[model samples]
Target: MKKDITIPVITDVYVAVVNEYNDIYKTQDWNAYIINDKDVDLDMVIIVTDGYSEKKMTSVFRKKLDVLPKKSYAKIELMQEDLFALNNRFKVSFFEGNTMYDKTYVFRKNTINLKALQNIPLMEAKGVLVK
Candidate 1:
């Protein structure tokens, strides 16, 4: 029975953390973005995010979008510097046409620092990408 079920593979979609200037606070803040690199659009996009560690955890945050167009990206959340000490996770789910797909991406504790920043697809800003 298990062999009969086909699980779709998720590709070209990713969650990243970028450092950007905040207009309101006039500060450089760490922000999360959902990047869609596929040729098709993603519908009913839902992302649940949280940060945790050995003895502590942050509140879970949920963000929804009607659609994410092809080769584009959307901002999900702003992460504080303190949360960088915890392992941050992003569970993303969406529909590509009639099929639904989901995947979890994680940024391990203490690994989101400046050294990890690199070229991200479809975005000029460099950031840490989950493989």
Candidate 2:
């Protein structure tokens, strides 16, 4: 009898690049060039609405990145299912008088890829992260 071996396949999932801006300026103007792309830039002062946890985390992450030193960039990659799992985790109450939604997403250590934002970067031209 021959035994069949099963191999787990790893695939490149979705990726997001975040950027944050200081409250002193308007984000729209600074982000005019990158908003259309999957990449995002946010201001220090972020507005939050009800039932919008996903958007909130996304905003906070961007803001944090914006405050980082110039020429910095971060990349996050996660499987579609893992991303949604995180979303569900944040939906539940995990803090005193607050939920994960109220806080920035706790990115797993080493999961974020940081690098210098090059002039006319590849991501800027492609408008997408290619694995």
**Best by the lDDT measure:** 1
How many clashing residue pairs are found in candidate 1?
0
Pairs that collide in candidate 2 are 20-62, 20-66
Cα lDDT tens digits for candidate 2, 47-113 = 1211124343342222222221223233322222223223311111111112121232233322323
In the range 30-121, model 1's lDDT, one tens digit per residue, is 88999999999999999999999999999999999999999999999988889989999999999999999989999999988888889888
lDDT of 2: 0.26
**Which candidate wins on TM-score?**
1
The residue ranges of model 2 lying beyond 4 angstroms of the native Cα positions read 1-5, 20-25, 28-131
Q: Residue 43, candidate 1: how far off, in angstroms?
A: 0.2
Question: How badly does each model clash, as a count of residue pairs?
Answer: 0, 2
In model 1, the runs with Cα more than 4 Å from the true position are none
Report how far off residue 16 is in candidate 1 (Å): 0.7
Candidate 1: lDDT of 25? 84
